[model samples]
Target chain A: MSRASWQAFREGAYHTLPLILGAIPFGIIFGTLGPASGLSVEATLLMSLLVFAGSAQFIALGLVATGTPVGLIIAVTFVVNLRHLLYSITLMPSVCHLPLNWRLTMAFWLTDETFAVAVSRMAPEHRTQFHWYYLGSALAMYGNWQLCTLLGVTAGQWIPGIENWGLDVAMAVTFIGIVVPQIKTRPKLLCAISACCLSLLWHDWPHHTGLIAAAIAAVVLALTAETMGQKKETSLKTGSKTT
Target chain B: MTEFILIVGMLAATYFVRLLPFALADRMRLPAILENALQYVPIAVLSAIIAPAVCLPEGYFWIDWKNPYLMAGLVSVIAAAIGRNLVITIFAGMATALSIKFLIV
Candidate 1:
């Protein structure tokens, strides 16, 4: 409520503007796919309101369309969102000193975009007002998502066969955008390759179990690859010292 | 009723995964191996999702060049690697898919 907090909040929201723009199509695509995938408008809106995790929601939609069990869907949602645990760990230093209510609200609002904007803008001295700036970014993204979902839902109803038009390519491509940049190292690249290939091989598995299996396999493989690389480097250094 | 339960379950799963870490942050000491594993979860899960959606767009093995999703997905991957921009990657993929769908195949 103070002037400085208000200014920080505005700056946080402003810095997040580009990310908000990137989310527009993504949000609309979710909205349209919800109804098309046999979800009621109420349920779709409520998912956006409550779950609020885009990738998980998209995966849920795909599973729901295939009549997968709700338990499996929720499990997949949990696995897909495990990355949030890492994000919270990284931001813990910045937010640990805050009150319970502030931390809880901030945790709920913590999306990929807000994390990027908040982490980059946070300073040790500005710790007190940083949550306000985070609030700005979170609120901006939250509002933008809800608005885009509404538009897509309305458009889905108005546009005939829009769902059949393969709007899911948006999600596929978006996933590509997300995964490609993160594949900088050999371990990450192999992880992605293994997951991609395994999912395809097990595509017909019941209950969408293939996805979970593939994800688990990829993570384990990456961890092993990383450990092996570390060992090789250490041994090489030791060998040079002895010689 | 089923939908309601599912949504509540998802809400609980997502919210708790996020909130529990913060509440327990003081006592939490994630092992280095666990941290490394967690880092790869996003890429692995997302790649799992993307591979099926693109490679089997029609719910079968459609790896042909004419498969619009496959072509566009490749384009998007290139765009993402080269441009490293979300909007451009999405636009490039969308443009390629739409063109191939309407014009070529």
Candidate 2:
């Protein structure tokens, strides 16, 4: 890679350093639970490497523990990860300048945490080299996931019930940090509030469909709020002009 | 064999969902309304994701006097809202939750 690309990559990785804390317990929990659920270490690692979706992986682990059919497990995971589609959509415009191969690799690596970091760092001056930064964050997250999962699979045996130690609560809190700064508008706040309430209400929904429902509700609500605000502005202007 | 199939299928489906629209982003002209709504996607999905993690840490819904998640999460959210600091929010949240869990369980 060029020196510029290399620098961008390092910057990306460095910025992602703090977010890695949130992913650590999550990856370790998945690692520990995978083996405990009767999955072989190899299969667990393969799933973490290839699938790389924590929510879906955890859901799969639960289903596997219950002896749910493989087909059903995949189906459930598909539904659970449909939110990634929204993620992809949100990231598209920012990533559209890259080559096809780079885009493909990025799409594969773009998780919630990486997306948060990458999007925030995409200032106008950095647009040309941002792909390098994206790669940096993506690879850092990938490496962390792999190493943490390995630790969980191997050393996790010595630490009994470590998955339940509430360490993963840090991830939820980190998520709040990611959301809090972006909520400058009333509609955005309401979007978060409504999504939070709906997700709780739909927590028990089958196959993680409730998450999608809540996300869709927030998007729709935000759209309505923005459009209505626009219309009201226009109507007030016309009314004053007529008066 | 079943696990293999599960992994492969999920890999294919998940990757497809991620790769397709991204590839199509340049070629497509999304409607303005859809574009506007996309702005809310990340925070909405994130907020939604957070709800279950705190409210149903054990994969079941429970929010009451006994659960530390709700209380701890509220603490973390307040910290995030006030401090806007990732490290502080995570550490404070985890510390609060762990302390409560330690005290209770």
Candidate 3:
């Protein structure tokens, strides 16, 4: 509510614009596909409103179309979203000091885009009001999602072949932009490379289990590299001291 | 009614996983090694997601050099490495991908 909070909120939303743009194509496509997949219009919109997770929603849509059991759909959604658990843990330190209500609200809105934007912006300088900025990013993404679903469900019929436009490339490139800059160390570079290779090799795994597997493996590899590097440095120091 | 149940089930499943850690944040004390791993989570996860999006654009491996998505992804990487601007990197990649899709191959 303070001017500073409002400014942080706006800045958060501003930084997330490219990501927001990236989601438009996917949003509209989800909207159109919901009905085509035999989901009632109300149910599709409700899923977007309540679940608010893009990947899970898409996977669920595929299952629903195949007439998969509801229990199976729910289980797959949980599995696919397990990656968010890691995200929640990673971000816990930053939000632990905030009130429970704020944390809960943020947890609900923690999509990939919002997480990417919020984590980068959660610098010490903005420590006090970073939640406001996060709220801004989350709310902006939420609003855009709803609007895109509306466009897809209602107006999507009028625009043919929107899915083939390859607009989803926007998201892929945006992610590259976000991740490449973060690769400042050799360990991180290897961690990312391992993740990429593992995910590709395991791409066909059901329920996006591959993504979670690849991420965990990559993290473990990076930790090993870091620990080895530290040990080498310490050993060298001890040897020089003896010399 | 089944659809309603399905929706509620999904909402519960999705929200619970995301909320559990935050709810326990105060009590959760991660080990130093795990904390160190957390730093790599973002890059690893994003890279994991990006690989399939580019190479498996058609839901199967298509790792050709001429794959437009691959080409555009490389451009975005270079742009980010050189420019370090999110907006510029996205624009450069999008322009490359779209032009190749619409104009060339």
Models 1 onward score TM values of: 0.76, 0.94, 0.95
DockQ of each: 0.58, 0.76, 0.81
Which interface RMSD values do the candidates have, in the order shown? 3.7, 1.3, 1.1
Candidate 1 per-residue lDDT, tens place, A135-224, comes to 999999899888888888987568766656666687688768777988889999999999999999998886457877888899899989
- Candidate 1: lDDT of A5? 95
TM-score of 1: 0.76
| lDDT (tens digit, per residue) of candidate 2 on B65-101 | 5677777789888988899888888888878888888
Tens digits of lDDT, candidate 3, B1-105: 998999999999999999998888877778876776888989989999998999888897777766778889989999999999988998899899888888887
Give the Cα RMSD of candidate 1: 4.2
Ranking by TM-score: 3, 2, 1
In terms of lDDT, the poorest run of 10 residues in model 3 chain A is A118-127
Give the candidate number with the greatest TM-score: 3
DockQ of 3: 0.81
**Highest lDDT: which candidate?**
3
The weakest ten consecutive residues by lDDT in model 1 chain B span B24-33
A1-243 per-residue lDDT for model 2 (tens digits)? 999999999999998887899899989989999989978899999998999888788888988999999888878877887888888887777777778888888989878888888877656798888899999999999999999999999888789999878787878888887898889998898899999999988877888788899989988888788778889999999999999
Encode model 3's per-residue lDDT on A155-174: one tens digit a residue: 98688887677877877998
